[model samples]
Target: MLSGWEFIPFLTDYLGGDIHAPQEQFWFLNNFSDLVTSSFQNVCGGDVLNGRSLGILLIITLFVGWLFVKNDATNLLIYVLGVTLALCSTTFIDWTSLSHNELIMNTIGNIQFPFRLVPYAGLFLSVIASFVICNIIDGITSNNYKQILVIISFVLISVCGYFGTVQPALDRITQNVSEKYLKKTESKQTIPDDVVIDKYNYNAIFDYLTQTGETDYYSEKAYNNATSIINNIVYVNGKESKLIAEYKPNKIIYMIHAQKGDKIDLPVIAYKLTSVSDNGKKVKFNQSKRGTVEILARTNVNRIEVSYKPIVLYYVMMFIALLSWFGVIFYQVKNVKNRLIY
Candidate 1:
């Protein structure tokens, strides 16, 4: 992407030696695009909470006992606030119940969480300091139920740290490149007669998402998802059926249109239909002998891509958020010059 900066020169030459043309067309991005890219990055950027690996919980427990075991109102207040924020920012909880048996995971997936809308989820990073003041418990202090809970809480933190910060940035970068270079294009207006419009059947795709799953999703409200799609197939002369399917499809369908005066052989139908995946191939049957033929209105296809990614960067980001927390603490101490509660 950095090398693509040279394209500006080529564009400038093409635009009649106007040097600024290259900068405008190829190199320089609009202010709005830059702003959006910077501001709304948390949902699409690096993971912020993968710090679960840092063992901050271990150090925190030790420090709390050393500094505030005797009694410190400031410490207690900070600890309580940090605990509340950590729980709010992380963890998986039932936002609501769906159907009779399903519990919806709503906490982490929620967009309304603080710092969830910016780079690395942009927390003030004060949660740790808050805990430092109230560092009353941890595996080091009490390894019973409290220890387990603390570890579990960190797990949630890791999840939020990963998704809100790192994952979103990766997604955004990939999408940016694709949009910049490999933009999606609508096919020609007129689909070939032999072309099967199987993808045109969108309703069927949604049906599969709802009915085909043996395991219910995090939310029973999956069909109405923003990323979800609806498929519908209006088969000509009732030759095919309509299906409302999920955005992600698992079934393959095709609209077959046999040419006039062709022998509609069974083997040919199977052979020809198989090739639909690679090209716009059609199976032609004998139109005259009660032979069936039709143009397919595709409504659905299997999910060809995914929005989530692996955990490599998520791990790195965990480090950054963790360190960032300390940075925030030092900044506060240096600036405020007072050891008081938030």
Candidate 2:
């Protein structure tokens, strides 16, 4: 969560608040069938589950109820959690109407997808389903009835796996192959020399500091007219300076020569988590209307580094998580050693 655009506060607000509505949709009765089998379909689409999938879910629900009756506490808890997750994930609420409420929209609407929690629900339900099948098989004393139950379970599982997972994955792979290779080769589209690629085309929310417009390159006029501290150009002593930029995941390094009073403009956008250093020493930086970073050289600056560094609290939490994971692994290893010795 501390990585990438998640660390940017304004970007988070723009994504969770401004653009969450289009992702919202209501769940239907057939959605439960889709949820149980992990059926892939657009939430906003009018697609309905087939009768066979629906029937499978109905049988699974019946088994869940039976497990509850038999006082199978573990499976019952798992089933309830699955249902709760399904209900909360854009399923029950009329978010289309609730989208007007700022608090509600920011909090619950942050999910951005109706099916965000559906996969977890499906996982829990799958565990319960397997447990229920085992229980049913164990309870059957007659060999003939046990064999029939086993065959039925196997058939149902195979059908569900094929339709829910394998077929959808195959279809996606075929579509991607056709679109990426076949379609491009067939069309033979050539790029125009005048056409400049917009790196921030897909990243609209990151431009909150700029608020240039819906489009990145098209909104340059707005940022250009604004009184931003930085410009799109690098300067040394009031003269434009050329620099080489090395991009990385967490940081960007610039190889530029600068004397005192030189204002260097970095290509990277300015965010709350962004930090700038001149020759490994922290430097004060200003944000442009276009969200670019500008720094005045105090000394002869050779190498400048701009990085996205999360706060101390993020590192503390990460340390705790790693420690906890190691503890669990050590305990499990000890238990395995003891079992082997016995």
Candidate 3:
């Protein structure tokens, strides 16, 4: 990504302040109880609290405290990491407050949202929870209380999860399906049937539009444009022209019916690494006012191809990542086998 500095936005810095954490989400003594009570809010998308779920979470949290008393090396490390990451996820200084400090606004502001670190915090907490459960089960033969506690923990987790996250999420899905797909509304009818309803289509990030003097990337025109459509219609000299676009995941081929010397504006973004070939010969392209690629028809070209060619370093890093994954899996499997044999 660093190699293709011209194509990728926000490589060196990001100045998007609107995406930062809000004042309401800041951690404070008065709202500290929300750490447990807001479990339902995280899942179901509302601030509504479930008393039973809150009680279950609070019990689990107190159970986590027992790990500190036990003082196992691995458990202690996991506990410290989890607590530190959780605190990092909270907004110590609100977005508005951070705007005053230029140093913080430039450094920490690049993260976009501090809450994005919450997943890492949750991952460590989950590992600790699993360790605690396994330890309790292993000690159950010596102490009957361990067995009782294990049973209670399982029961409470299941019940609370069903009411707090599972059931509410299911309800939300049903509501969305009915409102979005099932219900026949005038607004929904205007949407084209060919438009692909995928995660990429709804990408909220508009760092690409930053070059176009657009500050609020969330605006409708900034993200959604003619290029976003599956069947991208070509425009020649600001007029609609007959063209057939064959779209693929990484490449696009446009068969345009244009004369020589016609300036063609293709419905695709002009990235530095984007290679354009007219007929069989490679041709240079320029960025139009709207940041779309503009190609000049040196000859009456029927076929034009566009594809991304990433730097060699990207492939090298990808290969290293695959090797690392294999190495980790092999070590883990070997360790498990050794334990079993012993």
TM-score of each: 0.21, 0.50, 0.58
Candidate with better lDDT, 1 vs 2: 2
Estimate, for each residue in 1-342, the C-alpha lDDT of model 2 and write its tens digit.
223333444353233332212333322333454544433332211133322121244335534455543476776787787666665543364545676777776677545555566566666767666676556665764464554567577789777654653454344335544233311122213322112223432122122233222223222423443333222245454466544455555777787777786777665566556799988888888864445677887777557889977666666666766777788899977875664455
Per-residue lDDT, model 1, residue 60, is 40
**Model 3, 64-174: lDDT tens per residue?**
645443668877777677666655655433555665677876666545555555567666766776677666676665444555566678889767775765555455445
Best candidate according to lDDT: 3
**Which runs in model 1 stand beyond 4 Å of their true positions?**
1-70, 90-93, 97-342
How are the candidates ranked when ordered by lDDT, highest leading? 3, 2, 1
The TM-score, computed over Cα atoms with residue i paired to residue i, of candidate 3 is 0.58
Worst ten in a row by lDDT for model 1: 20-29
Instruction: Rank the models by TM-score, top first.
Output: 3, 2, 1
